[model samples]
Target: MILILGGTTEGRIAASIVDEGEKTFYYSTKGNEQEIALKHGVRLAGALDKKELIRFCREKEIRLIIDAAHPFAKELHDTVYYAADELNTPVIRYERIYPKLDTDVDGIFQHLDYDGVMSSLREDKVRRLLTLTGVKSIAKLKPYWKEKGVQCYCRILDRDSSRELALKEEFPEENLVYDTPDESLDELLKRLRPEAVLIKESGISGGFLEKTAIIRQNKIPIYLVNRPQLKPSARTVDGEYGLRATIDEFLPQFFPLHTGISTGTCATAAARFAYAKILSPSPYVFIDKERIPVILPGGETIPVQIHSFSGSFSLRRIEATVSVRKNGGSDPDVTHGMLISATVSIEWDHTKEMRLLKEGELPEIIFHAGEGVGTVTLPGLGLEVGGPAINATPRKMIRENFEAVIERACVPIYSTPIHVTISVEGGKEIAARTFNPRLGIEGGISIIGTSGIVRPFSSEAFVNAIRKEMEVAQATGAPRIVINSGAKSERMVRNQYPDLPPQAFVHYGNFIGETIQIASELGIERVTLGVMIGKAVKLAEGHLDTHSKQVTMNREFLATLAHEAGCSDETVSAITQLTLARELWTLLTPSELTAFTSLLISRCAQHCQPLLPNGELTVLLISEEGVIYG
Candidate 1:
């Protein structure tokens, strides 16, 4: 279905994103030197020209191609592009993150290609040179060194194949240095005492900045070769999230479940753009404007859209409003496709909005709840009663993003105060479908996302919701919490815990392991796990996460369980042939039910009890007919 051209870091990143899916793709490299680990990708080594690539695409029926090879691999890039174009297939370029070049800096020389670099070196007549480029460039740089007999030490990989390539180019063997010496690059330059250092614009991951720092320390001029030009119409994406989203657009069924961004990230991106636009020259933005990249908690930046912007200027303050619609990620929660907006107001002299700020308060940024955003009504959720229900991580993200803008805008921290109001359109109606009412959050959805991204079923959002529920349950002083897979099991187990409050019942989806672990970490003394037949079968087999992706139903294991329970050969064989785990109830007789249920509960407890050493654990197996097993 797809082909990925890889051998560099970008290629590895592309492979990781594709591994999240179920379909098998091809990952090709020029040689077998790069070691990679892939789950569903077939590895093909050696190069392919234009005609061969076209034939390969035809044979494999590749509908999409991802070009993630090295930037200097111009021939491969052209071949793949032409082949994909002839086949009428789309291409997604996994581009590397490049730092802006500063030609004004001393000891740095920029050139368009290797010929320019060699011509400049010849003009300067440098005697000693240290090259950090790879072994493949031996022939390209030979003219500059061989013609004048310059002393050049080219650093390359420590493989025999690399040395043979240099020898084939008639380059001296003693002039080649192998990879990974004990000394630092700075120390290497000192030891070699070369007149110049050579490097390519290899971006941040290639250690380009560190190599330049060594050159600056030695005060040696460095020749930097720019990256080769790529096709103008290539579709490029820089973040991992972008790759997944694009793949889904091409192949809808590539991933069983898709991923999405959180409301907090959406709110943050909206506020970041609004604050920047309010201060910049532009005041109006259309829905078709460019996407703005937001920095994630993990330090990776993902581009998000900011639209419906309107800015106005007044005597005391200037304000702008922008909204970001959540993408169609795997998790289609209430907030998905909802508009998370931020209205940012900057008080020029702190005169009009002075009363809103506390006396002597230094933080230039303040947050407020708008129409649809909720307000805290209780103490345990970590916010003052009557305050906005935005969580700590989103608040931190807003402040950090604002600080970057202020630093760039040359605005003093104490000069003006910026107020941001975050709201979700139609949030009040959405809150009814959520657990916000039980958690003492009223009016709308609470801005929440710990990782700023959401995976589909059995994601961090599900686990986070469970943790918050337990916190509220413990705050209510409930002696035990009842955790269930979903509404059906929770309703079946409710009558057993009649005295427990409503907050005591929490749903964990497929996150049985996370639910109990959170209760244990919070020092909750008792936990009750109510699981349906499908998840219970997987949990009994020591699979904590009962998601089908992690573990599926094993008929052979169930046959063993039935045989151990003293079932007849007919019943054992029937279990192995049953389509669903719930069908076991009809197949089992009343005589062997108790022993089978007991063995299943015993096995589930073995893997779950150690997590809650200080607490009492109860595993309840609920049947399709509302039968209570253990």
Candidate 2:
């Protein structure tokens, strides 16, 4: 249903994001040399002309095309662009993150093309040169190095194929140097000491900064080839998360399951826009017609709709109130459609505070818990007791957002404190339906979300999805189908079964009972169930559905295991006091842990093996730190 043109790192990342679901997709590359891991993606290696591309899209019924190939692949980019346009298929360009501006070094020069570099080389009368540009650029610089009779050393990837390419171009063997960490950039510069260095403006991930740092230190004249400008496609996303979100939008019905944003992101977007209004003109305050852009934790900026708020101001303090109604997408989040509000109050200070007086310091930020947000009632959740229940991640996002607003507006952060209060509409009524009440969060719901994006893996929806996967495994003739609790467990167990196909592995996401039942009905003979400590503890107690709502971790049951495993009285008591199951790794001795883990997994197997009576079941216990034992 989707085709991704990839032969680069961004292409691999895009494949991983799209592979999250059970549906099949295609990943194409110019060569088969680039090693990439994929599960649901069918790898297609070879350059596709416009005819081949359009034919493939039609044959495969590809509704979406992701151009994640190298930025310099202009011909391929053009082919895909025009093909997609002809087919009326949406294309999401996975653009790489590049420096906002060229590196400001005295010796560094920018060239629009290789011809300028050759012209500059002739002007400088340079005979010796060093190029950090890739092997493909060697052909482009033939006139400068070969025709001009200049001795140029080219650095390329340390691989047999690269050396073969250089040889095929008739480049001197002595002129080819492989890029290796064993040879430091500084050491390379010292040995060569060429008159100039040539590099591509390859951004941070390309090791451009590392290369330039040494070149700058050596004071060598360097020419950086500007990256080819890409025409604006239908849509573009820099990060994998953003790519996934865009894919969901373009192919709204491609995957049966759709992803959603976190409540933390919703709150951060609301708070971010509320503070931006403080710096905006009077007319911008009441007009909430435009969607406000908020940068997510993953470094992707997304626009969120903000409601009109009552803006007020005072001489010493200016305050703005804004709300973002949470969109839960395909997830059945209790806070869906709830109004998450942020009230930002800015004050001017006559007396400079310590933060303002410090070097490289901004204004102090203070957070408040308003009407529907919860307060921390206990420790161990990593929040100060009696403080606002906003998580550390949300707090960081809020501060970053506020600072971006201040810097963008070019306004000084005054010495006074800027207070931000977050409130969720009807959050208290919803808290009872969530784990907040049991987690000792009082008053209302807590601002949460570790990744700022939630995978829609709810019970009924996930079960239906897994049934399709089980049928696929049966049809594919897989030796054994792996059923992990979720992504975390699946990742940890991947090394154990490196040869297993991605389709052979499935994410059960708290549906242990249902997944095994489907496997039994589908005649899946061998099943490997991977579970983390948290779910292992609950599954050991015979809970078919190990959902947080269906089961709270029973410390009493864990204490019994610790006691039976010959744990000391103190250890047994400590198990009862544990806030999370993973804490058992720290609370018990190594020997005691091994015994307890065995007892736990055995109990889990006892309950699970019956579900797959006609099949063999292997239970894997993944530790908190991702160590797998059983």
Candidate 3:
């Protein structure tokens, strides 16, 4: 949630920006000003003290505070800073843009503070003064003006409260000039015919420029009190766009969140940094080579950070290790916070033991799976029977980044043999939560990433994985392909098809239509789709993309189907009112279950027919009790 401290024009603009979303509160001191309108969730609160402000933030669960108050509101600024510090909340200041003053002008003098303005007035010996500063400081200036024998005329807001305050301060009623929105400052100045004009340097919205122009036109000297210098407690922005950008960066978890670099990209960056450190004498080496911007398969070129590095040099060998922490952005990835490290070692030998490469070829780059790195024991996966679990894309990334750094360092490409071992901390424990064990990847998690970037809830990544799996399965000369919604459904289907190879099982995630279409394009003779009850219902309704955000189960459609299957009105109503699709199985009788499953299978097969025109498509609905229908 956001809290906006507002009153000025910039504050109103900030309020408008936050109004686009819920969970925001707009605040102001003056109740007489125009009230801001917002959506249902946004609240508008009046003035608050330091203690009340902190309590308000705590009660509202405010994550961010925007200080967009008037620049001259020094006490309010201090209070906001104190309250925000107590709450440990991030604050952004929307500062007003002050106009640049021309000190070179004939009779314009700028004073740093109120004292300076008074000192300047004393030296000038002005007979009459017209002050545009607000009524709050009228008492402070009354002494100096009275001592100088200057008749002062003060302009303040035309409000009963303002007049009462001025009168209470002992300021003469005859000299007090009440200002309305429609009043002209030039006419007032002409009527008073003061010797000099004194005004505070409020920003453009405060009419500082207009007052100065009128003073100059009347050939009267103007003394301006410069704005107060208050140190901000948080980051500050001047304009509306800057405020929006800052808000986006601060609270990206809310909406329009940005994607982050993948673990594969982190490993690649670590490999490059490690290789560069071995070649350079300094503690750190910065590579400045341009090679296609190191794009991830997802087509995003994100920046990477080298978290830590260490190196050592021994007889005829140089070794360096670097670590990079993976950032999953807003995605709930298992490896989001894992530290992926790479150790690069270069060995040189003048004897016959050294391996030589052909001309124009690089050194022999060998990859090793260190601790926390998995090894492939399965035949279906696109890896050697016994090799490192690093997938093809990450391997390519590591090789390319290492080669690029070596080339820039001007190292001998053909002489030294480079060995890179990639590892992840606590990877084995992390792998337990994934499908690595089921896929026959033993020891630890696989260093697998097709795109070096991981987008939050990315459908493209899942679709791409399905396509890769299909290609691998087709490469194995498999006549039939198995597609499942998730790991659970895949396991159930695998048990049913014990003879099918591991490569033949593809996890389509939510892209059922895409999987069938890709399988048909790959020339597979048969396709089997394994679905759980939750997704089976959506598929039966012809939803190819079964993500809840894309499509929802239509209870009316289910009722119609149940009625056509010869269920009574009461049974049909129960089916329609059911919250979960799985609940229907418990409510339905044996005959109803048979009729419903048959109808659902026929509808699903009809939808799959267009995607797999050349191949035969089959649907298998499975649950914990085993295959419900096939």
Best by lDDT: 2
Give the local distance difference test score of model 3: 0.74
List RMSD in Å for every model shown.
16.6, 5.5, 22.4
lDDT of each residue in 66-170, candidate 1, tens digit only? 999998888899998899889999999887767656667656899999999998988888878999888888889988778766899998888988999999999
Q: Using Cα atoms with residue i matched to residue i, what is each candidate's TM-score against the true structure?
A: 0.65, 0.77, 0.42
Relative to the true structure, how large is the alpha-carbon lDDT of every model? 0.81, 0.81, 0.74
Counting clashing residue pairs in each candidate, in order, gives 1, 0, 0
lDDT of 2 by residue, 226-318 (tens): 888877855777775678778777777666776667789888988888888887766244554667767767566666677657677778778
Off by over 4 Å in 1: 100-109, 119-126, 147-149, 181-187, 209-222, 272-282, 285-290, 305-307, 313-318, 350-365, 374-418, 428-444, 459-630
Q: Which wins on TM-score, candidate 1 or candidate 3?
A: 1
RMSD, model 2, all Cα superposed? 5.5
Model 1 clash number: 1
Q: What order do candidates take by TM-score, descending? A: 2, 1, 3
Candidate number of the best TM-score:
2
Model 3 off-target regions past 4 Å?
40-46, 254-630
Q: Residue by residue across 233-267, what tens digits does model 3's lDDT show?
A: 58777654456656867886443433566677877
